[model samples]
Target: MTKSLEGRVALITGASRGLGREIAQRLAQDGASVALLDRKAHWAEDLVAEIESTGGKAVALGSDVSDRKALTAAFESAVSALGRLDIVVNNAMWTKYAAIEDIDEESLDRMLGVGVAGIIWGTQAAAAAMRQQGGGSIVNIASVSARLGLPQAMVYCGIKAAVEGMTRSAAIELAPAGIRVNAVAPSTVATEGVRAMLDEATFEARVASTPLGRLGATSDIAEAVLFFADPMRSGFVTGQSLLVDGGISVALR
Candidate 1:
């Protein structure tokens, strides 16, 4: 809350709810002007108001992250409203739980479009805008599914794994422009969407398996993102994927 990100402008996709919402608030608290981009134009209005109420700057725009043209326009709109772009958070994703054999073509395409293609499009848009202004930071929200093999999550796992791959490759490719690309892979967190997806027994089982005896909090993931976003902390770091899985990953290993 020291305004480390003062004067910086950040754009986050899927900014309506869950991790995206929390990350937006976190950045705003650090003095970064945030642009909330969600599929529905009005979805982030309340969030924009929330930030404004606290003396933070925010704008809400509607665009599907999977569409390059629309996404590019959204980036332009954010810059138009906020003056400049400094941080880009590619947190938009569409997911479906299915067994390997049950994964349908339509579902696979949707997942790939939002989860994988969205990253590429976001990186492209951010790189274009950041290149003009010298440099910026890109934080992709991956998942523990990328590192662990979870049942009934074949499509999700594959897409998240691609996120890690894209993060590294983009980091190397964009370094010369002074842009930094990194990934944050979170374990199961207590989000509305997650709670809705899981049943009581499964939720308790996850807690029992986790070494920390509790699920991750939105703040835990946001703090990790702050570490990467604050150039003072991670200016020299890029292409790294920080796993915020509450030590469950290690316990399983």
Candidate 2:
């Protein structure tokens, strides 16, 4: 009765809330020991407890993913605590919505720092740890905003587009080292952050625009991530981006 990721160790950034939290729990349920890394370490402790209650191994770490040194240290700590590293999900991000003309330099820097630089550092750290283990998988959480222009989300869109490009380039570079890189792009998922950002009318409009006729659930994105994280499910898949937006990306509507 061995699970697909029975002996795997995974690290997920932004694991304190929303989609990040869901992904952590799902991976744990599949028997992968998880390290939940967030800006505030204590924010993830409750999730750690929940996973442990289900007989899963979990740990929480605090670090600014934008800082290379801090991120590398967190990765090292994750491996030290979990015994090894086999998977990583680059899911942490910070964003602010403003008109293109109103975009501030500080907010832009923070968004790029978290959304772009964070992925790079996470990839570097995960690859180093996985190199020793022979091979591993890394999944970056992207957004459909990368492909479609959304008002007040210019910076966020740019970051996600960069993520996809990096995923491809990193896959090619790391593939030789036995590490696979990929990304999952989700659209209008009903996460706490998404809910907080959108008004009722906006939320309904998002649903109406999707062919699926409903907003995506956190589990939906988590399952997409699991497909990439589990070697048995996606061993030969790399350098690809799966859009888990319930048909929103392709719908004519």
Candidate 3:
């Protein structure tokens, strides 16, 4: 019996935790040999072990996404280890919240460095591998902040918007090579980091705004990514951003 991703290899940045972790696990379960890239090497290693224990194939790569050379090398190493790269997910990002007036240079630079530059480098490296392998899919983890005005998150908003724009441009350029580029924009998800950051009131308000009346689960976003990552599911989809926000993007605020 052939699996959905049988014989395919996938590389996912930020695979140590949260949505990235789930995405990596999902891909592996679907039968892809997953390369888990994360700055926290130990975490990725642990996840890789867990996946392997479940009869899935996975490898951990500790590489800083912000470093173009390191990221490029990591992509190559993934290919060498996994055999070939067919799916790439640019999910690593850095963010620091500050009001527009309080925004600082360092924070902005770091956010853009990882969110923007990292995606660019990842796309470049993956395109090179995928073009050689015949074709591939790339999924950028964007955010609803890119489409909505969020106070104290201007930098994050801008960075995500940039990612969405890049997704479209890359799709157009890579289409000729049979490479597909797309993005998944998720709203506030109930991850450990988010739960720690949002107080009760704020959290409830966010959930209330969503038609689903609940925060997104890691699996929700992971399923959306799987859709984009599989050619059989999204063969004709490209240059588009799917909002996995449970109708929040449409609810009148």
lDDT of 2 at 188: 85
Question: RMSD for each model, in Å, please?
Answer: 1.1, 0.7, 0.9
Q: 1-253 in candidate 2: lDDT tens per residue?
A: 8888998999999999999999999999999999999998999999999999989999999999999999999999999998999999999999898999999999999999999999999999999999998999999999898899899988989999999999999999999888999999999889888888999999999999999889999999999999999998999999999998878788886
Query: How many times do residue backbones clash in model 1?
Result: 0
lDDT of each: 0.93, 0.94, 0.93
Error of 2 at 128 (Å): 0.9
lDDT of 3 by residue, 40-138 (tens): 667788899999999888999988898989999999999999899999999998879998899998988889889999999999999999999789999
Clashing pairs in 1: none
The best-first sequence of candidates by lDDT reads 2, 1, 3
Question: Which residue pairs clash in candidate 2?
Answer: none
Q: Could you tell me which 10 consecutive residues in candidate 1 have the lowest summed lDDT?
A: 244-253
| TM-score: model 1 vs. ground truth | 0.98
For candidate 2, give the lDDT. 0.94
**Tens-digit lDDT track of model 1 for 1-253:** 4689999999999999999999999999999999999999799999999999999999999998889899999999999999999999999988889888898999898889999989999999999999998999999999888989999998899889999999999999999999999999999999999899999999998888888889999999989898888898899999999999888888953
For model 2 the local lDDT of residue 74 reads 98
